[model samples]
Target: MSDTQAGQIGEDDHGHPAASKARLRLWLKLLKATKHVEAELRENLRTAFDTTLPRFDVMAALYRAESGLKMSELSSVLRVSNGNVTGIVDRLVDDGVLVRVPVDHDRRATTVRLTNAGREQFAAMAARHEAWIDEMLGGIDTSEIRAMTDQLERIASTNAKREG
Candidate 1:
């Protein structure tokens, strides 16, 4: 069947048109919701903290690690390239919120950790972030939220299995 026919109202030889269209609509809705939430978060971080999402993400990762993470490890955890992470790390280091310590027995490697001030700052941001998320998703009840979470997890698991 043609692409247009596949998206039309009736079934073709392959599968039910209604089911395919429903799945397509679901995918679009999911994408829209994700983008909307991400844009709101990016704006919130910028306006409230005068910080970008990338910087917040770097700090968050380090905050969770406590002892900090190596530069390469940070990049890996963030799923970003080393070059992309370097610029954010550089700015954080200059801001005195993050410190770089030379790794033992490794001349070319360094680990990044948040300073005392950085930890305090992140804690405030994290609390606010949680509230923001709660507020945005407040329309959904607890059970619905749990159900949706489980469904999304299933989708992720399916995709992981396919890829692996």
Candidate 2:
């Protein structure tokens, strides 16, 4: 393979180099891989579940911990703003897929949990989600996936530390 063809200096339609390229080619590949994964998940969630990705994401979190999640807690876990959570939750609540329950003794506090139907739907979609991730990782073997996961975790930890 040519030097530029070795995953660096990707050429454009006019045989020109990418306009704005990163020196770290590996990071660029990683970003592209992440976007691919997200796009696949979004399409799958839409077709298989007829649910928007973000709303499904919220429900998936609650489905994992069936007891419930506070609005603030879900916001933190989803890494989204409270207003965004409010919009998603409102739709879910209206559809009877989720319920907002009052905190046992603290009237002001509330938690969100999937309703029976929501739990059932989440269970089905969760299975498909797993399958989709597996299919997306088709070329890679088990060992490679583990190694990639470790490297990503390391990168994430470094960035988190840097931001902190």
Candidate 3:
């Protein structure tokens, strides 16, 4: 049985344990909030930068890696298929935002890294992204945000323990 189902021996029409129902409601709320934020960001990215979120995500991953990453490594880190990574990498390369270099020892392998221009471009976008996020979440009280973060961290830790 799944971790959630383990507590379902006496579930009702509404899925009792009250805690379970509460968690389900919380999950839905989280999903809705995430979608709302993402939709805004998606529209803003297109309007402001003419870039897709996937491209931004790929660039963000590359920015995090100082030495760049292999195509396969990028795929793994981004939780995407190699073909998906290839397309983004191709476009970025064409835009002079990134370069693919052959590995010295591995003739068949190549690594993708951001160029200086890419770094500058992404840095600008990242700052704007941060402001967007702040604006999106500006309505929430700071204390409530802190409390929610702490609760989410506890849930994350619990899930990590279970998965580990």
Question: Number of the top candidate by TM-score?
Answer: 1
Question: Per-residue alpha-carbon lDDT of model 3 for 18-67, expressed as tens digits?
Answer: 55676789899999999999999999889999999999999999999969
lDDT of each: 0.93, 0.88, 0.92
Q: Write the per-residue lDDT of candidate 2 for residues 19-73, one digit (tens) a residue.
A: 3344357778888999999998998898877888898899989998789999999
Whole-model alpha-carbon lDDT for candidate 2: 0.88
Clash pairs for candidate 2: none
User: Against the hidden true structure, what lDDT does model 3 obtain?
Assistant: 0.92
Q: Which number leads on lDDT?
A: 1
Candidate that beats the other on lDDT, 1 or 2, i.e. the better one: 1
The sequence of per-residue lDDT tens digits that candidate 1 reaches over residues 15-52 is 76766767889999999998999899999999999999
Winner on TM-score (1 vs 3): 1
Using all chains and alpha carbons, the TM-scores for the candidates as numbered come to 0.88, 0.81, 0.86
- Over 4 Å off in model 1, which ranges? 1-16
Q: Give candidates' CA RMSD values in order.
A: 5.0, 5.0, 5.1
